[model samples]
Target: MRKNTVGTAVTLCAAALLTAGLGTASAAPATSPAAAHGAQAQRQPRQPVLVDCAFQPQARPDAFILACGDGNSRLASLHWQHWDGRTAVARGVNLVNDCKPYCAAGKFHSYPVVVRLAHPEPWKKRPQVRQFTQLSLTFTGARPAGYDRVVTLPLWS
Candidate 1:
């Protein structure tokens, strides 16, 4: 049983890497004319985005990971109500793992939430991309244990 659990974790991690590699290049920011001309200052303001673990900039993704190193927490069934150059708003379900005995044996729990992305700043790792620096989730219904009705976390830059 222990061996089976390890195998499952390994398989899930492998799948994540594969999917990230196979993701569409269209998800990356397009090089604008100004960018091509090396006119960094003249470039039009690009839409703020959220980068996945793959480091791909996504304008409005259906799902997003809250924990990047592991697949323990994520936002699912995202329905974006607004996405502008500055901020984003959405309604989604926060799926979190309750790692009881262990992470591999954990059970996932769902919490209905209102999602907000704010503070658009140039990503330190990818300067060309404007990434949302913060994430705020207001739990509309159930939430993870030891969490507040509203939880705000800093997104990976």
Candidate 2:
């Protein structure tokens, strides 16, 4: 009986070692639907926001003015980037250390802030503006400090 018990234990131990050596260590197979969907999402290309301009001549470079929410005077600064032909991106930040009267006081009305390109106009080799076209806006980041909010604007010229 003692010999039989010893032999069984040795066999089990040997089997475990063999499995490990064969690279057959157990790993949970990804079988959940959420896991599969998440993987697929990662593989898919991201989409951009589409906007239509109603203002005359649409909103063009050095002409598109942005009206950001005002009141707290927390607005720190504004930056703009020109893309392709009909798209513009603007980012704003509230660079206030403390929400005091010195930095941010009012927090009610919307402030009309205009943003223009640092580059010269007349897109030399670019296509001529004819009419309003579809636009896309993608917001990247936002926080209480620095430029955390990004706005994509649509303009025609």
Candidate 3:
């Protein structure tokens, strides 16, 4: 009877160890699902989208028309003269309307403009622009004496 009691105690102890091992293994698999989700998130990075001013004029001021009339002010053409990934120089035309009396009877005007695109620094405080933060427009040729030569517009309204 003494030998039988000792054997029963050893068997119980072995069963407890086996159960504990199985529990650890099952828990490891459960944790792997969460780990896989984390890996997937890390694999996907945020992609930057290029600005299209025709659709979002206020968002992309660099390519927007001045003095909009009946939503007719738009970027007619853009010829990229120089681009080095970070900065770009382009020549474009802003088809705007000179609202002499009002928008209903406004005349369309084509303005030649120089476009410059610059990447924004992390410390800049432009909440309206995303991706590229600095967009400057300089009107080519002659302009009004008091008119500004360079106009920096927000990427967003």
* Best prediction by TM-score: 1
Estimate, for each residue in 54-94, the C-alpha lDDT of model 1 and write its tens digit: 88778789999888888999999999999998889999999
Number of clashing pairs, model 1? 0
Candidate 2 segments exceeding 4 Å error: 1-14, 20-27, 48-88, 91-157
What is candidate 2's CA lDDT for residue 3?
A: 100
| Candidate 3 residue-wise lDDT, 72-91, digit = tens | 56665777776553666778
Q: Which ten residues in a row have the lowest lDDT in candidate 2?
A: 45-54
Give the candidates in order of lDDT, highest first.
1, 3, 2
Score residue 120 of candidate 2 by CA lDDT.
19
Weakest lDDT window of 10 consecutive positions for candidate 1: 37-46
| lDDT per residue (tens digit) for residues 40-70 in model 2 | 6554312221122233333323322233233
Task: Rank all candidate structures by their TM-score, best first, as comma-separated numbers.
Answer: 1, 3, 2
Output the worst ten-in-a-row residue range by lDDT, candidate 3. 121-130
Best by lDDT: 1
Estimate the TM-score of every prediction.
0.70, 0.22, 0.48
**lDDT (C-alpha) at residue 135 in model 2:** 27
* Candidate 1 to truth, TM: 0.70
Model 2 TM-score, all chains together:
0.22
